[model samples]
Target: MNVKNVYIAYTNCITPLGFDVDSNVQAIANGVSGIRLQENSTLMTAPFYAGVIDSDKLNTAFAALSDAKATRLEKMMVLALDPIIKKSGVELNAKTALILSTTKGNITVLNENAVPVPDAYLHQLAQNIVDFFGFTTQPIVVSNACVSGIMAVSVAKRLVQAGLYDNVFVISGDEVSEFVLSGFNSFQAMSDVPCKPYSANRKGVTLGEAAAAALVTINNSEAKAKIAGDGSINDANHISGPSRTGEGLVRSIESAFNEAGVTAQNIDYISAHGTATPFNDEMEAVAFNRLGLNEVPVNSLKGYYGHTLGASGLLETVIGLESMARNKVFASMGYDEPGVSQPINVLAANLDTPVNCFLKTASGFGGCNTAVVFQKVNNGR
Candidate 1:
């Protein structure tokens, strides 16, 4: 692939922290948290907090479609995508490529039946989007667990670079359901309270439901950031666990750097996939220290976003670019004491820094991991 320029035209996200890109960036800048305790409920019966979007507001905004037979996951995807689609002025048609990413796509339907596998549930969700937009092109679904969003972006880049499509619509979403909650409960990975990433007293993860989308193109003159290079690699060590020494993550990072032709010191900020889990955080620390970037500002939006699963990688990368435009970086909230023995400088407060280039890393199940390097285009636009 001899692609030179890739642009993120616009990003729209619905998270517990903020509703849109501007508000989300503000929350990140102020070091605000979106996690709140969830009361007893049939779908989610845990004491941990979550970053949930305002359902009432969403319902009001989408009231016109109330008569339609749209699932909650589908509604959430449209809600996150409405703003960007409206601004892009790009009609949803065969000319547009739709790449949907999710870990558990509309699994709530399966929970209602309990007679089908996860894959069946996913195909149905893809059909919903294709029908919603009345598109003739086949919808491509990527389900590489937590790295799904970044993987979706990588695919979109390739398709555009290949001239398969001029505009790519990347939508990622996952909703809270009983099945996933029970699975995490079985793993004993649900936090009792709001998650505290990189903190010594951190408990576990608090799953969050969210959807976000970005319009990608080869010639987006209004992009907030440019996609310089992206790389993905599998560790093949464990399907559900990460490498202890962060070897896989290191490999992905090296590939991203080589693709971007940028060195370690060129990276000004890192949006880590700090899921607050014991193994994940420890592995991230090792990766950062090994890269000799222990001094650079490092933080995880998981503290605020509460780990949006499939939507997280794109959501965090969007925030990284927005923060660069704003000239400030968010601190890893709920982080006071270092949890790992590694000398990783977990940011304690928001800092004003010149961010020219940033890196986003994600590690997920199936030994899948990805690293994407983004640079701010200084074309004086």
Candidate 2:
């Protein structure tokens, strides 16, 4: 079998912060956060903080696309993918695949008055988007808890390597619905303010919603970031929490390192999955310490976008790629003092240091952990 190099060719983002990557990155560069205090009696009896997109703004963006008929979630997904597909100028043929990543696909339909076809089925969500864009191949939906985003990318790379497709477009999204809000609230995991990841006074998580898309292709010449390696492992530690000792995360990172022929020393930075939860942050710290990556500068995008569920992994990866292109390391927002017991270099301020290679990681419910290695394309190292 012939192995092909996978490269992220184009990217797009639609989040509470902004509708496109440039706007969102600028917001981060200026220390702006999308998270805000929200009041929805149906979702929660009391006020809660969350990163939620404005309904009017979403409608405007979707209206601009002449797709006003799509549901809010579907609009976000299509709005995310349309730009990348246009930018890539890649035709949707039999060899080109479309992948949708989300934990909840139109789950809001359950609480809304609109009755959708094949209602609430994730497959229908993917089909709706692909059907709009005229993809010849069957739509693929990935919904593995919060790992859905990066997992979709990993799956796309593997499929491309196996000659199932020459190009794959992965779009991941999840809306901040009443169901999700109540679910997190039930866990006592909803923070009252913008999350402070890896901070001494950190609280719990602030949920967010977003849709992001990237084109992964075998053509490395026009690549933004090269997908060097990727891996996933499950410890079955708990249903909603990660391993206390970071066993699964460590193994996942090691697997990617082995496949990419890189080491802890080779990594320039870590795009950590710091959810701002006490146990989650500590577990990530332990993992980095055990892997000899204690000093690697790391930041969690959650401080800006909050925990965006399945969209987070892909959203952060897209921003990480932008960081490499610009040579600017955005600060881990809301981080002041180290709270985790282990020694981990959590970024407190933005660094202008040049980055060549970085690791993106995500640990989700059901003890699923995934890590992927990416290197800057055409960097003059």
Candidate 3:
């Protein structure tokens, strides 16, 4: 048996800020936020802050690809993956695979007055994209709550390492809809203003919508970053809350560190899952402190993109890769002061620094937590 090293060949994303990776990077660098006060009776009764993509812009871009009837979420998924697949120039054969990550795939269809559509099924949503791209392998769906995106990366790495596939294309997306809005509102987690992750004045999460795609392959010709290691663990503590001791997140990071052969000191930066929720932020702070990463520069993109849910992990991962490549760390928007009981270095201002290795983490409902370590490729090593 032999092991293969996986590298991120290419990446792209569709967000309210921009369509491609470069645009999104510029937006973040400029401190631009996609989350805004959205007023739409169709999605929610009262005005709330969220990161909703422009429907017209999405349709206009998607129209160029295909006129075939597809749901809004489907359109986003396809749009996010199209450029990456074309750029990679990989053959769509049995040895190549497609993985879709989303917690609510086509879940908006249930809000319609008409009969339910088959696309509401996760597999069906995936099938639509698979058929559109003509992928020969059965599409794999990783929908483990909010960890779905980064977990998809872990899945791809394992598949390629095991020789199950030579190339794996991963795309993740979720749209802001009435269902999600109402669900968060019901939990009293919908913030009145744009979310401020890890801030004393933080209220709650501001929902967001986005689609991000990445190419995981044994090829390193155009590698953006090497996927060194990853881990996903469930604490089984609660249904919707995280562990009080941050045990799950701590273990998840430790697993990633052990596999990557790097400790907390080696992590130059951290893209944390700061959802702006009290429990989540505190849990992450405790976890980092437990892992002796308190002084590490950490930031959460939730302030700019809000909580993008299933799309968040990979979206942040893509942004983190860009940060490493550009040698700059974007500010953790909305973080004014320390809000958590534990001490952690939450970046309030953008820093121009060299980032060699970084960690991306996500925690979600059902006590799920995932962590992945990525390092910049040097001299094609």
Top candidate when judged by lDDT against the true structure: 3
Per-residue accuracy of model 1 over 42-81 as CA lDDT, tens digit each? 7665454777776777676567644566767788887777
Worst 10 residues of 2 by lDDT: 110-119
Compose the digit string of candidate 3's lDDT tens values, residues 199-238. Answer: 9988999999999999999888888888998999887799
TM-score of each: 0.94, 0.97, 0.98
- TM-score computed on alpha carbons, candidate 3: 0.98
Error of 3 at 263 (Å): 0.6
Error of 1 at 306 (Å): 0.8
Give the Å error, residue 79, model 1: 1.2
Each model's backbone clash number: 0, 0, 0
lDDT of 2: 0.90
The TM-score obtained by model 2 is 0.97
How would you order the candidates by TM-score, starting with the best? 3, 2, 1
Q: Count steric clashes of candidate 3.
A: 0
| lDDT on C-alpha atoms for all candidate structures | 0.81, 0.90, 0.92
Window of ten residues with lowest summed lDDT in model 1: 111-120
Residues 197-276, model 2: lDDT tens digits: 99988888999999999999988766888888999999668988889999889999999899888999989999999999
Candidate 1 overall Cα lDDT vs. reference?
A: 0.81
